[model samples]
Target: MKSSIVLGLGFGDEGKGVVTDWLCRQAQRPLVVRFSGGHQAGHTVVDGAGRSHVFSNFGAGTLAGAATFWSSYCTFHPVGVANEHRALVDLGLAPVLYVAGLAAVTTPYDLLYNRVLEANQRHGSCGLGFGATVARHAGPHKLHVMDLFDDFVLEQKLGSVAAYYRQLGVSFAEEVLEQQLEDFYRAVDYCRTAIHCTCGRAHFKNAADHYDSLIFEGSQGLLLDQEFGYFPHVTRAHVSSRNALEMIREYGLPEPQVFYVTRAYQTRHGNGPLTLEHLAPQLHPTPYETNVHNPWQGEQRRSLLDLNQLRYALSADAQYAAGLARQLVVTCLDQLDGPWWVSDDDRRTTLDTVSELAHRLGGHWQNCYGNYGQAGNLVAG
Candidate 1:
C-alpha cells in the first residue's frame, strides 16, 4: 500500500477537494488525512452523483465513505465543525469524522482578536482567527481541545490571553469575555463526545496494514506556505508534500505517488500577487462567499500562470519528490483559448495576460510547460 499527498500549487481555492475526491474513487477505502491549517480553508467536493458539498472544517472524503483525520497542526472550530456536520447530515451524508486529541481549539477570544487585528492592519487575512490562535498558542499558556473539559485550566488560559491582549491596548468587556468563554466550553463539550479523536497512530496503522492506499490532502498552496511562500502574507502552515511525507514516515508506510495540482489559468484568493487583468474575459469571477472584502474582484478576469512562478513551485516539489516521486497535474485547461503564448511580428503575447505582467515583474518565463492536457496528463513537447 502507498500513502500519497495531493496539494495545491497556488494561493488556495485550487479545487483540491475535487482532486481529492477523484483520487479517492481510484483508491480502495483510502484514509484521508489533513495535515495543516483549519476552518480557514474552503474545499468544495462534487460527488459522482453530481451533488456538491462545500466544506470548511470537514474533509473532502466525508461524502465518499473515507475516514478523515485532522492532525495536531490543524485548529478546531467546534461550532463550524458541528454546523458542517449538520449540513452533511441534511444532505444525507455521514457525520463520522475524527480529530486529533491534541488539536488546538479556536476560542471566541481568538476570533475577536483576529477581527481586531485585521481591522487595524492589512495582512489580507481571512479573519478566521487562524493567525490569532497561533499567536495565542505561542504564548505562555497553550490550550488544546483536550483542555476544554478542564474548566479551571481553560479559564486560566483564556484569562492569560485576555490579559495579554489588554496589555496590547486591545479591550474586551468582562461580560463579553465571560460569555465567549462559556460558549467555547459548551462547543468543546459537544464536540468531545462527537468527533474528537486520538487516531493518528491507529489510523496510520490501519492504512499501513489494511488499506491499499492513503491520501493526505493539503490546504493552501506552495506560494502561501509559511516557509517557502511570500513572507508575512502566507498561511501559518506547511502547505507542501513534506508534511505528508513526514506523517507517512512516522507510520512506516510505503511511498505513494505525489500529485501537484495547478490550474491552466492561475487564480488566487485574498490579497496577493496575481495576473488576473490579462486573463480572458470568459474567465470572469463568480460570486463566492468568503471573509475577503472584494471576493468578486478576481472573478472579473482569469489569472495567467507565471512560468517563472510555476517553476519556483515545481522546484520546491522536486525537492520533496526524492522518495515517492512526483508529477504535475494541470487543471482547467479549457479556460485557455490558445497556445501558452501568442507571438506577433515583433512582440510576444501570452495566452494568459497575467503571464505578461509577471514577466514585467522581473519573473522569467523559460520553464512553462510547453505541452499539457485538460485532464492533467502531460505530453512531452
Candidate 2:
C-alpha cells in the first residue's frame, strides 16, 4: 500500500527522473504510473555507475527494473515505443510496459501536422505530435492503443486523421505518405508484441496486489498545465496532481506521499514568460546538460530561483493535494557557485545553505531532500 507521486514544481527539467529512480530503489517492486503528458517527456536519469539515459517513451525508472503503466490520460506513440524498446534491450534491460486500452495513439500524420504547425506559429512545440494527437482525439477522428491491434479500425481512423490534417493545409507527397504509413504499421506490430494493453482503472485498482509500491510519475510541470498555464505556450495536458489524485481515489488508495521537485534555479524551454530570466546572471552550460538549443524547443533558458513563483505553484497544487503528505526536493545544488540566489519581487536574496532556503520557503514539508549530483540526501535537521 505504499505509494507516492512525483511532480515538477516549475517548468520541467526538475530532476523528476533522478528522484523517481531513487524512489524505485527503495521499493521492492515499483510500478511507475504516468498520469499526464506523453512521449514528449524527456526525463533524464544518471545511475551511480554514471550510466545515463534520457527517458521519453518509457518511465524514468526503467533502468531501475521498475515496470511502467501509461494511464488513460497519456498518449501512446508506437514508433517511439519501438525505438525506445530496442534501445533498452540493447542496454541489457528488459522493460515491462503497460498501456491503457483507451489511451490516445499518436500517428505519423500527427507528427507531420505538428511540425508544420510549429513552423508556422512557433508556439514552442516539442515536435513529437503529443498535443496534436490529443487534439485529434478531441475532434471527430480518434485512435487508441487498442485500435492499433485492429487493422480495419486503425486504417479508418488513420485515413481520417490524414484527411483532417490535409484540410488544415498540411500536405505531403503521396510516396512520402505511403512510406510513413509503412513504417508506422511496422512500428505498431513491434509495439503490439512488447506492450500489454489493459483497462487503466481496473488495473490500477488491483495494482497493489501485484506490486509492492506505486510511483506516479508526472510529466511537464505545474506551470505548463493546460488550465493554469499562460495559454498558447502551455502544454495540452494537466501537469498538476489533479489527474494523479483522481486515479488514486478511483483505485481506493491511501493518501500518497507527494514529492514536489525543482532545481536550485528556474528553467524553461521553448517560448514563455520566465521571471528573472533577463535579470539573473547567465550560467555557463554544464557539460552533462541534457537540454540544448533546438529549432523546435528553442534554447533552454535559466534564471535565479523565484521564491514567489515556487510558492504560487505550490499554492495552486494545494487544492488538489489536500491531506497528502508533501515533500520538497531541490536539485542541482552542485550547480550553485555560492549560496542560493533567489528572486522575490524587485529584490534578490541569497541563502547560505539548503537548510536556510527550506526554512525561508516557509512551508510544512514532512521532509526536504537536497540533490547535489546524481543522488539526493535528506537535509540535515
The C-alpha TM-scores of every prediction are 0.82, 0.95
Pairs of colliding residues, candidate 1 = 284-299, 285-299, 285-300
Q: Which ten residues in a row have the lowest lDDT in candidate 2?
A: 372-381
Across 1-381, the per-residue lDDT of candidate 2 in tens digits comes to 688999998988898998888889888888899999999999988776667788888899988899999998999989889999999898888999989999999988888778878988888789989989999899888888999898898889888888888788878777977787888899999998999999867787677688887899999988888878877989999889999889888878767999989998999998888998876643445656789988898988888998888888888888898777888888887777666678876589876766666677677778888887764443533
What TM-score does prediction 2 earn? Answer: 0.95
Per-residue lDDT tens digits for candidate 1, residues 7-57, read 787777666776776667777776778888888887777665656677678
The lDDT per prediction is 0.67, 0.85
